[model samples]
Target: MDEIRKNPDIVYTDKSGNRNYGYLSLGCDELSVLGGRSPLQVYSDFMRSFRDEFSNLLGETIMEIQVGMGPAGELRYPSYPESNGTWKFPGIGEFQCYDKYMLLSLKAAADQAGTVGT
Candidate 1:
């Protein structure tokens, strides 16, 4: 809706005709802004970020190899409310900032996604 697009925050929309909350777009540029890199490299940069951030949080340096050796799983959000519309599931705020910056390359990937959890 105009409210979301006009607002400073990004908005998600499944259909241009309907602006529901279930649509979750990945914004990478927001994450790049945090990491000091361009958004174009988000897909490849995510691993670096995951490793660096994990170490920062854990207070230990764990190489990508170590982390890669572990089982890799996918992380996704459920449907939820958007700027002014309500959605099926809420979002994770913890990773919002990261995903936002890293996903700017794709227009579908907006600056906003879910409610909060990151």
Candidate 2:
């Protein structure tokens, strides 16, 4: 909440004026600006880290990597090779394609009790 509100470009607000939360599209970071990478960079980094950690700890199929965010944020879906093509699991940054929320979700999912395998 604090992070989202700090950015002038992205802040949570409501007409009610009592309390509010809204979505904000954050641009890439310094590295993203210097290297010209899109939000996809962060997203992918997270995916890789999530998969590796989950596999090492929980050892589950994970079935698939569903990376995205909620109304408060975004963890945009795995970007296709050509905006219409799906490639292998890893991409440019490995875990660079995800945001904080996605990371948290992955942790929670891994912590849950399950078959821990396919």
Candidate 3:
């Protein structure tokens, strides 16, 4: 939590610079603060370790090993985070792609299409 607060580049920020307090997405190539590994790579390593350690019980004890993405493994941004106390039932979620890494990619794509400022 402290690291997220200190590193604004790792989270999404609103137009006024208020961050949503969510970590970078899986697709983000930016190295995470933990062990300087990307989130996806870290997840991969963890899954590999789990598989290796539980190889003997794969079919007997473990019926399935489900992998998930994003908040709660839903493959989406933490748009309606409950920690903020700003969201309620039926409330529309906010977009969460304002992180520095995403912004850089967006800028690059926009530049490629000649839509830098638009």
Q: Regarding lDDT, does 1 or 3 come out ahead?
A: 3
Task: Give the C-alpha miss distance for residue 97 in model 1, angstroms.
Answer: 22
> Highest lDDT among the candidates is held by which one?
3
Per-model TM values vs. the true structure: 0.24, 0.32, 0.74
lDDT of 1 by residue, 1-118 (tens): 3323543233233332233332223452344332354334654577778766676655445433432211133244423334444433445322232223223344343334533332
User: What lDDT score belongs to each candidate, Candidate 1 first?
Assistant: 0.38, 0.40, 0.68
Tell me the TM-score of model 1: 0.24
RMSD of each: 13.0, 19.9, 2.8
Q: What is the lDDT of residue 3 in candidate 2?
A: 45
lDDT of 2 by residue, 13-68 (tens): 22222221233333223234223443467568777887677875553555555544
Worst 10 residues of 2 by lDDT: 11-20
Q: Which one wins by lDDT: 2 or 3?
A: 3
Model 1's alpha-carbon lDDT is: 0.38
Native RMSD of candidate 1 (Å) = 13.0
Model 2 TM-score?
A: 0.32
lDDT of 2 at 12: 22
Off by over 4 Å in 3: 1-6, 30-33, 68-75
Residue-wise lDDT of candidate 3 within 1-118, one digit each (tens)?
5655566667765444556655564326557654576766777898899999999999999988776765567666677767667668889877667667677778888899999644
